[model samples]
Target: MAAPEPSSPAPDLPLLDEHRIAIDAPRDRVWAGLCRWSDTLGIGDRHPLGLLLGTQPRRGFERVELVPERVLGFAGRHRFSRYRLTFELAEITPVRTQVTARSNAEFPRLRGRAYHALVVGSGAHVVSVRRMLNSIRRESLKD
Candidate 1:
């Protein structure tokens, strides 16, 4: 895995951010599930934020790197602003996976920053992301 880049100003938020969760699933299963989420959720061309904002889908792709049962990285871009959302994973047990997602972008001023922050930092957005990932993990375990 590559070292994390320093956090930068998110155009929508005042602070760069990181969010993480642990799932009870084998690393391979977890990794595979994440790779397939775009098609599974019918968001193949849509930026995640677009879906969150109730806009139509746009073009984007999830970039996934696999390192067996030890590590995995999942990243996708927000189409309009090109913000990157990245998730890094570490296996803590045979069936436990720890994952962190970081949000980063370059915003010029406070208004833009606040706007982006509001959208990204909202509780509803956070919960939606968590639920989506958890659902992916659950589905992956079934195969």
Candidate 2:
């Protein structure tokens, strides 16, 4: 079955959104892609988004957790949206890996519900992550 539509934060559980995707590639290859992508976000890298989002265009995220090819985790704060993001990657098999992206956002007090109503309904978060996973897969397949 197809995925369900994205919805507003659960009234009971605000401030979080999680998304995951599995890539059809070996762990090492996927890891290389992830590292390459993140490297391009660091200072002296060529990615536009990194320069825009980073304070000094250096390593934008804190390496909260890492375990070589098996796991990688990062935490970062966004300047424009005032949101905290956590990224997690885990190797599920020799030929597959799972990527999870979580976002912690705060909307103005008493306006969270309305903000979620507008943002969650748009499914932008899911689409972005899906594209990220696809890009990782494609990059991993490269020589």
Candidate 3:
């Protein structure tokens, strides 16, 4: 799959959450850290959601796009929702990079709306995503 363009709209899916962080590390290092951390979380390129999706290695996410040290993306679906998460990296200076994590998702039907309220409205998704971004910053800055 291809990574969705950053400036482009997410089509029918709405923007669920977005977070940005500036890391005091090289682009390459941040890219590596992103891969490693996402992999360890078992959500890298695996379809680990369930049988409705596929029995893959990681969690519910599958890496749908990659662009070396620049862009990384993932998409997955369950009974209630279809979603995408994209991480874009831009070099601010030789020693710094800005990382933005964006999530777009569509929740269908009554059940799906309830699920959305439970996760998004409760702010759990924001906390989790922010923590993940921070973890990448920490890991990337490591020696």
Could you say which candidate leads in TM-score?
Answer: 3
Q: Taking the tens digit of each residue's C-alpha lDDT, what string does model 2 give over 13-121? A: 2356777778888778887887676554334445666666553223444454455665454444333333444456677887887877666665555454565555665
Question: For each predicted model, how many residue pairs clash, with residues at least 3 apart or on different chains?
Answer: 5, 0, 1
Which 10-residue window of candidate 3 scores lowest in summed lDDT? 3-12
- Candidate 3 overall Cα lDDT vs. reference? 0.78
Candidate 3: where is the Cα deviation over 4 Å? Answer: 1-12, 42-58
Q: Write one digit per residue (lDDT tens) for candidate 3, span 1-143.
A: 45535322233568887899999988999998898877755443534446544423227666767898988877767777788788999999998999999899988899889988998889998998999899999889777
Candidate number with the higher TM-score (1 or 2): 1
* TM per prediction: 0.59, 0.58, 0.80
Cα error, residue 59 of model 1, in Å, equals 2.5
Q: lDDT per residue, candidate 1, 9-59, as tens digits?
A: 223442356777788887777777765663554354445655763322233
Worst 10 residues of 1 by lDDT: 6-15
TM-score of 1: 0.59
**Cα-based RMSD of the predictions, in order?**
6.0, 9.3, 4.5
